[model samples]
Target: MADPQDRRPAGAAEVLERLGRLSLRELSMESLLQTVADLATTVLPGDLEASVSLLVRGSPTTVASTGQLAVDLDERQYERGHGPCLHAARTGELTMIADARTDDRWPDYTPRAAERGALSSLSVPLDIDVDEQVSGALNIYA
Candidate 1:
């Protein structure tokens, strides 16, 4: 299988061209999310599902989501107060959920995420607050 980040659709070239030309700081919050959605659509293989979240006060909130399933899964993680994403965001560790159904770590969240078709996920911590611990999370859901 191709690397998920290398996947692209018919119009992906154009979208990537635009994405490459813009900086995140130059875009509005809404535009930033749209750009992320566009990138997720074009850069991910197969179904190309994705969601991005920001951590505030140790809680994760969806900043952008390409589909409902992704949003639901993120919310599930937030609701449970524990999940790979949350842990990764707080501790600045890479969290990988290869298969939510079989992952025993998130007992409360795994089943719900699996029900929403999120088989795997990756959480990358972002240093939103330069003066504090990681203030946000950037999650990639698959």
Candidate 2:
């Protein structure tokens, strides 16, 4: 049974400490990453969602997500072949959409994302080893 008590840490440092102390021996990579995605929402101050996008064999995939909205949006971008997540993943640069409905960039994606209630978003590229042959980004939507 899951614990009823909500004991999430209150600050970024505490969260980082908790994450560092978490046991990974029994946790699958997906579970640990999902926890990171969930923790991102707690660390950021807003009503937002987060997801992890990974590029494997030149195909983008959502490896972890806080909610269906995050996963769905990632999938939408994946199917269309472009979006903040993919851009960040490929370029290892930060991608931010201040106003999805008005953003000139990603003309096809931003508007539809706004229609779905995503007013803004930030995509931060993750640092996976080049030797590993994988690239990814942490996408947050608000």
Clashing pairs in 2: none
Looking at model 1, the pairs that clash are: none
* TM-scores for the candidates: 0.76, 0.89
Candidate 1 has what TM-score?
A: 0.76
Error of 2 at 4 (Å): 14
Q: After superposition, how far is residue 94 of candidate 2 from its true place, in Å?
A: 1.1
Query: Across residues 1-142, which tens digit of lDDT does each residue of candidate 1 receive?
Result: 2244556664768777877888877888756765665576665456646666777665568887766776777788788888876777677788888888899997988887777777888876666677663365556777
For residues 1-142, could you state the per-residue lDDT of candidate 2 as single tens digits? 1121332436988789879987899788778878888777777766678899999867889999887889999999999999999999988899999999889888889888999889999999987867647889999999
Candidate number achieving the greatest lDDT relative to the actual structure:
2
Runs in model 1 deviating more than 4 A are 1-18, 23-26
Clashes of 2: 0
